[model samples]
Target chain A: MAGPSTYVPKSGFERWLDARLPVVRMMHGQFIEFPIPRNLNYMYTFGGILMIMLVSQIITGIVLVMHYTPHADMAFSSVEHIMRDVNYGWLLRYMHAVGASMFFIAVYLHIFRGLYYGSYKEPREVLWILGVVIFLLMMATAFMGYVLVWGQMSFWGATVITNFFSVFPIVGDTLVQWLWGGFAVDNPTLNRFFSLHYLLPFMIFGVVILHVWALHVTGQTNPTGVEVKQKSDTVPFTPYATVKDLFAMVLFLLLFSYFLFFLPNYLGHADNYIEADPLVTPTHIVPEWYFLPFYAILRAVPSALGGVLLMFGSIAVLFFLPWLDTSKVRSGAFRSIWFKAAFWLFAINAVWLGWLGSKPAEGWYVPAMQIGTIYYFAYFLIILPVLGLFETPKPLPNSITESVLKKNGGQIASGAGQPAGATSAPETKG
Target chain B: MAFFSSRSLKSLVIAAAVALVPAGSAFAAGDSKPPRMQDWSFAGVFGTYDRAQLQRGYQVFAENCSACHALSRIAFRNLMEPGGPEFSEAEVRAIAANYFVMDGPDSFGDMFEREARLSDRFPPPFPNQEAAVAAMGAYPPDFSLLAKARAPTRGFPGFVIDIFTQYQENGPDYIYSLLTGYDEEHVNPEGELGHYNPYFMAGEYIAMAPPLFDGMHVYQDGSPETIDQYARDVSAFMMWAAEPHLEQRKEMGFRVMAFLLIFGGLVYMTKRRVWSAVDH
Candidate 1:
């Protein structure tokens, strides 16, 4: 794939085009020669994996819409027709349903990868922040999409969530009215949500492109705790990184398929099968599993505004991650013992919050949720900040190459640098 | 070192500022109104006969109503199974062989059989939907969207007002009333407008005749051959056909959730591994 010579002849059309646009070569030169750290591991694959998921969701979603009816009268039954009557309707429906869960799964991994490696630090902060914005938009899109089925859960879940606007003090009632397009959640709400749900994913697609662009600009961080310096410290993104990402995608699909075929209804609600009855409520109303953690946080506070703020705050804290950490060190590997322990504790606490969210609010459930909620906030506020300043980091290698060579116990010749075993030489500066 | 510490301090300030902004307004808004229990229609599940039920109802319908009124939407395949009015393959051929369908080039087709395959679209009783619509006026609206469309009408205000006040049983009470409602004495001209089947939604009278027989199909399972049993079985089956994905959807829901948990674990582990080298 490498072209020979410092200059190569343009093709017939390109030769004519080259005269008009001199910047094309500059753009090519920048990207074609862009350096990336060689030590990037599997975690770096999530961004590309997320891109694949977005495309999968859009494609599956469009096909589903072909068979779907947005009208309130036919919407639920239309979904039923797709399930029972359409050819391979079962497969299409299951893929779209499960594809949603997978999308969230991938994005969470991508976001967490940024946190783990401090990918948001310095010049890369915009990329990480844009990812956070995408995450929020994704959450909104998924929420609206879930209501389109108009099943019992879909109906009630929309009612319960939209009703939250009523907690907004004086303007709350108006907000709720505006949201419903009437006094209650009905056909108009369904139509509007359907329109928006169809529209939002495309907007997310736009933001995602910006996310990747920013990422490419900052390049990628590596596990070696070093920045790319000489040409030897990096490798081209294609072939090497691309192949690795492809393998991960295949593996992800294998697991995804296991759920799609063997247990298609495993993530669904039983009450939804019973048509939505505004007159008769199901015994217990809960959202889909993915929303449980925030659901738990929402219920944790005694007051409505408190619960709303805390629930939103839990997500908002993520955006501030670029700044919250006080440590000079970037990687978790070199952080002090207490910080590592606190990280695990925080993760457990969040899981506990999710569990609490799924349970009906009762005597002990409220208290348990409150504690979990506190810990959830503490992890971001108290734990991350305190740990950053107090943690004593392990000595960092002088350079990315030094760390790799030291770990490998051998020094190969590095082009544009001193020969191997020249430890005495000053470390290459950025 | 001075520059590094300054940057770190700046980062801390930014983090604290973002985290604390929402803390001051932590009081959750109190819900002013009491939690309102939503009322849902139980009629579809409880009272209304499904196509399968109506199919048995169709057998009940055929032996009973076919002489007077016809359900033109139902096809031979519908009877072959438990859900609809047509007979089984052998029965359909034996029954319909006397009738003819339009054939290829010859203009004379053979009669329909009882059994159905994945390839077949539902066969229409009439030559075209237009003829069916013309025959029935409203074309006994397709039984496909019937359960959904008719359900709301079956739910009366009595049931709605009682739902929250009583919080009694789950399914629609009006359906149970409509199913067993037939009483000839209660059929006053003003009160009962039509034939007063009682099982009909608008109090007994309906344009369509009571389309069920006491014993239409012999139970292959050797269960009791009663009209009520047939009604229940057909209704349940229709419910299944209408929502084939119901069981699967619910099951998938649980599975997707389990998958999420597993995925969440993988994310946590992946995070740990990726961040393993990072300090604070």
Candidate 2:
């Protein structure tokens, strides 16, 4: 399923272990010699950056759970205690809080990159679906983690969002009660949320293993959207992709540190710092920034049930995106001008919806949100599919190497197709 | 041919129009006034709180605001912690000893009030809301997280500019404005008698009256005790209360970012050296 392992054990102890386990050989095959498209751009590095973020969140989260109290009475004060008393506890807490926001930021970019390059197309559907599942798990984990803070927004956000299940008619009210472990969001709810918040991340970790496995099976899709034709079209994973990934990872960490240290609360709502008060509701109830677009969809519809269905439907459509746009061309680069226009319109509409979500539901926001919502659904359900049938894509280069050479002004040796910008140009034989 | 040829241009115009709607609405009248920005000592990426300013702020709170507002999340020892006012251990011990904290149950199995311990949270002035409201005719909010909880929503261009400039002093800015924004000429009946601050978010009035005056609190360290000075100092102290680890956080961030840059450069070099033999 992977490239053939070329590992050779040098010592007798290593050889003996290799014969029994072969794990080292498996690592060598998967990471060392795996073929990657040489045309990959910086956007490809988000996958590695995401991996680092996930591990960082997990480590910081484990330390946080050590001091966090799950009881509603103690939870808010306990968090305060951690900030005031525990050694370096503030760093761990801030990292986990800010890390969730960073994770969503990276994932959104990754998803958009996939959309732009048709990464979800044939032979990669399973890989794409796994990513959607991972995203769903992330949303669930983050929602529960927010509730564990026991702040006003945490308690009420949980109450309001979980109450959405009541739109299900027959089983709705009971389902919400079951989920909350009571009639309302209270002590039991906080405890259960704390439990699930801890459990979901491990499940995400398990699913991530499957996600990477699926990616390796199909190999990575490149920016040019051209498949590797031969040895010349690809580069080995370690030195080529690894170094680039490392460099990108460092850049990502710099941004993360900027938020963690300098503007830690920029992404957070001020209302959340106040302890949860069931009797006195906050003037404005808003979710984290990552959930804003979906929140917009929920409020776009007037009917309660309709709003719930549409909100879930927005994410549900992503599961079917691989089949939704029938375009055969893998890259937006080659798609007709009309299709590209629609693509950007779709992006702008989504962002507009997010802005609307943060605004009050009255005034001009209501009508604007409705229009934005319509465009959002239209772009996926009508525009993409219909455009694919009529749009003419630009002619694809014969190979990735050919595409690379053409982009470089055709300066390289044509027959052998040496990379014109290959490293250490002075060392190349004349 | 015309319809098909102009399709992209048509959509571009529509997109531009749709984008302008929000900006236009943001400028419309009847919207709440935006809070004025203050020159906080802790406003930017590298900005750290001035320990002396924070201590002065703490004095103001202790003398005036602490009568009504509870700093329940703060411990006396926190004043001595890094990135805070950095009071001496002896001073912290003395401060803690001044307050009465409810402790409890000895051989007779009864709750008892005792002197505050270093670990005890700051005691609330009132036992509950009913008593509090009866005493002051309003509920005084807790100061524990008030600095973090109150901030003006910066709209439009200022919001966009705030990102690149790393402007995150909104909470303290709002507090400072509220402290100094009282108008004696105009009174709003919505708030409690003698309390009117237009800078408050809810209405043109607030429950808490202007608590500070020029030279109300004497500064033994020779610093001015003007209303503006007191407001700034108290705001700085609240920022510290909300985020006690600010200095350490910024210091560590600089070191981490520096390391990443050097490491990234080395990795880039290694990538180039290793890919020297590749031919596309």
lDDT of 2 by residue, B139-210 (tens): 898887788888777766676687688888888888888888888787454635655665777665567777
Model 1 TM-score on a 0 to 1 scale: 0.64
In candidate 1 chain A, what residue range of length 10 has the lowest lDDT sum?
A421-430
Off by over 4 Å in 1: A1-34, A412-430, B1-280
Model no. 1, DockQ: 0.04
Task: Residues B124-212, candidate 1: write the lDDT tens digits.
Answer: 45555468657755344333333322232112343345333433212222233333344546545765344455334322244444455
lDDT of 2: 0.81
lDDT by residue (A165-217, candidate 2, tens digit) is 86687987688779878666789999888888889989999999999999998
Off by over 4 Å in 2: A1-3, A410-430, B1-32, B188-194, B276-280
Worst 10 residues of 2 chain A by lDDT: A421-430
List lDDT for all candidates, in order. Answer: 0.60, 0.81
